[model samples]
Target: MKLYSYFRSSSAYRVRIALNHKQIPYEYIPVHLLKDGGEQKTSAYGKINSKHEVPVLEDKNVRLSQSVAIFLYLDRANLNNPLFPKAFPDFEKCFELVELINSGIQPLQNLAVLKKLKKDFEINDEQKVQWIKDIIRNGLLAYSKKISDEGPYSMGTELTAADMFLIPQLYNAHRYEIDFTGLEKLLQIERTCLMLDSFKTAHPDIQPDSV
Candidate 1:
């Protein structure tokens, strides 16, 4: 197995956490997103992933893109450390947290969207930061409300994909200095998740290509 990834990418970070949690050993191939006109846009990488995105997993003959899909694929392929808790009541509840980060918050605040805002809208750095903060703040608040004082993890005691999604988003939040005034639950979840070795090893700062 191999993973083509960018260290700073939240989506790639999600996959890294999942991989680590499952204890799946794979070669890490770094694709610099901002070096020399972005390596992901190059024809070579483009052929690997039509979308020219990071976090593309290559397992034998299969190549997969998208973090959520990769997480599901990894979960299905490996039964040892399942990403989703089979015994949990209403699996959708756990997925709700994952979707909140993966679909709702992540896409809006990702590097691609930020670059588009700057290039297309001609938004200044200050405006861009404010826009990102507002969107993230609102989304995080909504996500926070979903956690019913569940203590450690998002769903419950056992870590799930929701925690995998949360750690990277929180990393992004901290990068932009997004306000976490009333997000104690989410903050607590982040704190707890980071305590685990899987999350610690998957962190961007420690990755091979983090700059």
Candidate 2:
């Protein structure tokens, strides 16, 4: 198995946490996104993932994109620890968290959007930061209310793809200097993730290409 990843990408970070949680060993092929004005845009990497995104997983001669799908695939292939709930309702609840992260938080604050604001809209740094904060604040606030019923983790005690998604978004929050205090449940979730080794090892600072 192999993971084509960028060190600072939140999406890639999500998959890294999942791999670590399952104790799945794979070779890491670093795709330096910033060098030469983002390597993910190069023709070479684009052929592997038409979407031109990081965290593409190649296993059993199958190349997969999207972090949640990759997590489910690895969980099924390894069959060691279950990342998603098996019971019908419980499983749906887990997926609810995944949707909240994937659809809610990720799209608004991704690097591509940030860059577009600067390049296309000519938004200054402060404005860009404010835009990011506004979007993330709304999404996280709603998530805090919705996921309140769950335990320390996103959906329950067990770590799911949602938790994997949360840590990286929180890191993005910190990167933008966004204040998370308004979202208490999110703060609790981030605190809990900090205590886990999977998040620790997958952090951008420890990655090979991180500055």
Candidate 3:
């Protein structure tokens, strides 16, 4: 197994955490997203993932691009620690939280959208920061309400793909200095999850290509 990743990419970071949690060993191929005008834009990497994104996983005869797809693959292929719930509302609930970050907030705040805003809309840095803060604040508040009351992990006692989706978003929050003021639930979740070795190993700062 091999993973093509970019240090500091929230998508890749989550995949790393999942890999570590499952105790799966794989080669880490670093794709520098920022150097030389973004290596992911190059034709070579483009063929690997036409979407021009990191967190691409190649295992046996299969290759995957999206983080959620990779998570699904890893969960089934490994069979050791399942990332999704086996039951009804729990399964739907997990996906609800995943989609909340996967599509709702992540896409809006990703590097591609920020670049588009600066180039086309001519938005300044302050405008970009404010836009990020407003979106994150609203989304996180909703997350605080949606998460289970069972404590620790997002879905309660067990860590699911929802937490995988979440930890990275919180990392981005800190990256942009977004305020955590009223969101004690999320703060507590972050504190609890980070205490685990899986999250520790997958952190952006410790990656081979981190700079």
How many backbone clashes are present in model 3?
0
In angstroms, the error of model 1 at 46 is 0.7
**Candidates' C-alpha lDDT:** 0.89, 0.83, 0.92
Q: Highest TM-score among the candidates is held by which one? A: 3
What does candidate 2 score on TM? 0.93
What is the full ranking by lDDT, best candidate first?
3, 1, 2
Q: Name the TM-score of candidate 1.
A: 0.96
RMSD of each: 1.2, 1.5, 0.8
List, residue by residue over 29-124, the lDDT tens digit for candidate 1: 999999998999999998999999898999999999998889889988998788977765747788888899888998897778999999999999
lDDT of 3 by residue, 80-162 (tens): 88889989989899999999998889899888999999999999999999999888878888988999887888999988999
lDDT comparison, 1 vs 3, better candidate: 3
**Candidate closer to the true structure by TM-score (higher is better), 1 or 2:** 1
Better of 2 and 3 by TM-score: 3
Could you give candidate 2's per-residue lDDT for residues 27-115 as a string of tens digits? Answer: 88999877888888998889998888888999987899998889888888888767787888878877887788788888877878889
Top lDDT model: 3
